[model samples]
Target: MTAPDSSAPLGVFDSGVGGLTVVRALRELLPDESIIYLGDTARVPYGSKSPDTIRRFSVEDTQFLVGHGVKAVIVACNTATAHALPLLQSTFRVPVIGVLEPGVEATLSDPNCERVGIIGTAGTIRSSAYQYALAMRKPGLQIHAIPTPLLVPFVEEGWTDHPALESVLHEYLTPLLDKGVDTLVLGCTHYPLLVPLLKKMLGDQLRLVDSASTCAAHVKTLLEAQNLLRLPGEKPTLDIYLTDLAEQAEALAKRFLGSTFNKVKKATL
Candidate 1:
C-alpha cells in the first residue's frame, strides 16, 4: 500500500448522522484538514445488531472510505468501534482510530475519577469495551455502564429538548447519579447533542466526557505524529456521504454538525 498523503482527507463513518458531531469537532480542531464522512444510514442503529453483523458492516464502511483515498479512518460509531476496531486496524493500511479509546483516555485523565458511569448503545455496553478499557488502565476503578438505546433515536429525531426526553434522561442517568459517579462518559457520538440537556438536568458536578471532541483531539495527535497534518493556507473542505438519505437527513445533519453541515451524497456501500 502506498503511504497516505498529507493532502488526503480524513475519513470518518458512523451508523448514521451522529458521526457529524465528530466532524464538527474535527473542523474546529484541524481547520486545514479536509474530511470525508460516510454515514451508513441504510443500516442505521448497528447497536442492536449481532457482533458478526456489526463487524461486517464496519469493514464495508472502512472499505468505502479507503476507496475514497482518505488518510485515516475514524470509526465514529460506538457500537462499531466496540466490535470491529481490532479487525479494522489489522485490515486497513491507513490509520484506523476508534471513538472508544479517546473517550476512555479522557475519562481516566481525571485523577479524581474513581467512579465512572458510561452510557451508550446496547452493543457498546454489552461488549464492555469502555468498561474493560477503564478497568485495565485504572485497576479497581468503579465502572457502571448502561445502554440507553432510546436516546439515539430521540437525538436523531431532533427531540433533544422534548419534555419526554427529560423523563428518559432521568430514567437512564438516575442510577448512575445514585452510584455517586464523579465522571460520565457520553459513549455514543450522538450523545453530545444531548449535552446541553444533560448539563441542565445533572447540573455542575457531573464531569461529562464527550467522545466526539476527545476523538477529534486524538485524530489530530495521530496525524501530527505521523506527519500527516495538512498544510496551512489551504482551505479545508468536508464531503458527506450517506448509504441511505432520508428526507430529514439534511435537518439531522445540520442539527449534529451545526454550521459545518454539507450536502450529502449517496454511498453504495
Candidate 2:
C-alpha cells in the first residue's frame, strides 16, 4: 500500500496521444497538483482490439503509471474505461477513476439533457458503455451511438479540420442530428478536436457535450473526497511518457497541453 502522506503524481493513461485532451482539462482544473500521463502510442488505437487485449493493455498501462509513484489513476480511454475499469480499480491499491461513469453522471445530472447522442470509435460504441451508464442513471433517456473510426486517425495526424473532415462529420453525425438529439457526447477523447466542425454540422439546435471537462471536474471531486488534494506550497509538475513516436507525441502535446513540456520522456511501457 502507498504511504498515507505520499505526494506522488496522479496518473492518467490512454492508448494514444488522444488522452492529452483529458490531461489538458485536468491541468486547468487542478493547477496545483502534479500529473503523470502515459500514452501507449506504439499500440495506438484500442478501438479495434478485443476485450481481453484491452484489459491487458489497460492493466499494463496502469501498472506502468503506478511505478512512477502516482497515488491515483484515471483510465482516460473510452475503450479501456468500458472494458478494463473494474480490473484496474480492483487491482490497483490507489483510487482508479474512468471517464465513462463521470461523463454519464454529468449528462444525467444536467436536467436539460433528455436525448443524448454518442460519437466514438467502434469499440466504445460496440461496448455500449455510455448507453449502459446512461440507462442506469436515467432509465428513460434516449441515447444514440455512432461509430467513428476516422476521427481518431485524423486527430492523431494533427489535422483537426480539412475538407475531408466535414464530409466525414456529416456522414457520421447526420443520423444523430435527424434523431433530434439535444446533447451529443464526444465519446472519444480524440473527438474534441472536431468540436467546431461538429457544432457547425449539428447547428445551434444540438449541444455538444465534452467528456474531458466533466471528467476533469470529477477527478478534482474525487481527490477532494478522498482528501488527496495536493499539499500547500508545492510546485505542481506534469510528466509525460509515450511509447516511441516522439515527434507525434510532441506535436499533440503542444496542441492540447498549450505549453511546451521539457519533461516529456519516451518509454516502452
Candidate 3:
C-alpha cells in the first residue's frame, strides 16, 4: 500500500466518545491536519468484551478508517489498545498508535513516584497491559491497577461530581491511597472528565497523568519524523463517524473538541 499524502486525514478510533479527549489534544498540537474519528458506539464500552472481540472490533475500525484514506490510525481506547495494539500495528500499513504505552510512559516519568496507581475499565485492568509495560521497562517498579468501570457511565451521564459518584470514587481510590501511591494514571480517556473531582479527593500530593495529551504529543513526533506532517496555519476539517447513532457522542465531541462538529454520520463494520 502506498503511503498517503501529507494532507490526508489522520484516523482515530475509540469504543465511544472518550476518544474525543485525544482529538482535543491532536487539534491543539496539529492544527492544520484533518482528522477522521470513528466511535464504535454501537458496541460502546469494550471494557467487558473478550480479547478476541476487541481485536476484531479494532480491525474493523482500522479498515473503516483506511478506507477513508487516512495517513495513520490512532487507537484512542485504552481497552482496545490493551487488547489489540500489537495486532493493529502488524496488520495495518499505516502507523498505528495506542494509548497504553504513552500513558505508561507518562506515569513512569515522575522521578519521585514510588508506588503508581492505574484506573481504567475492566478489560484494560484484566489485560494487565499497564502492569506488564511498567514491569518490562522497570522490573522493580511497584504498580497497582483498579478497574473503575462505573466511571465511564457516570462521565457519559455528565455526573462527574454526584454524591453517588463521590461514594464510588472513594471506594475505588481508598485502597490505592492505602497502598501509598504517589502518582495516579487516568488509564481511560473518559476519566479525564473526572480530573477536577479526583484532584479534590486525592489532593496535591498525588500526580495525575493524563494520556490524551501525551498520546497527541507522541503523534506529532511520529508524523514529523516520518515527514508526514501537514502544513500549518490552516483550518482543518474533522469528519466524525460512529457505528450507531449517539446524541451524547455529538454533545461530548463539542465539549471536548471545543467546537461544534457539522458532520456526523452513522457507520457499520
Mark the regions of model 2 whose C-alpha exceeds 4 Å error after superposition: 2-6
RMSD of each: 1.1, 1.6, 1.4
- Which residue pairs of candidate 2 clash? none
User: lDDT of candidate 3?
Assistant: 0.88
Per-residue lDDT for 118 in model 3? 91
**Tens-place lDDT digits, model 3, residues 1-269:** 57768989999999988898899889888989999999999998798788999999999999999999999999999989998999999998999999888888887787776788999888888899999998888777889999888898888778888999999999999999999888999999888888899889878969998879889988999999999999865688999898887666678777656678877888888
TM-score of each: 0.97, 0.94, 0.95
Off by over 4 Å in 1: none
- For residues 147-228, could you state the per-residue lDDT of candidate 1 as single tens digits? 8989988998889999999999999999999999999999999999999999999888799999999999999999999999
List the lowest-lDDT window of 10 residues for candidate 3: 249-258
Candidate 1 total steric clashes? 0
Give the per-residue Cα lDDT of candidate 1 at 239: 92
Highest lDDT scorer: 1
Better of 2 and 3 by TM-score: 3
The C-alpha lDDT values of all candidates are 0.93, 0.84, 0.88
Candidate 2 per-residue lDDT over residues 1-269, each given as its tens digit: 45534467889999987788888889889888888999898897788899999999999999898888898998889999999999988998888999898788777777989889998889999999999889887878999998988887677666777888778887887888888889888898877778877766666887777778888999999888888888857788888888876655687777866677776788776
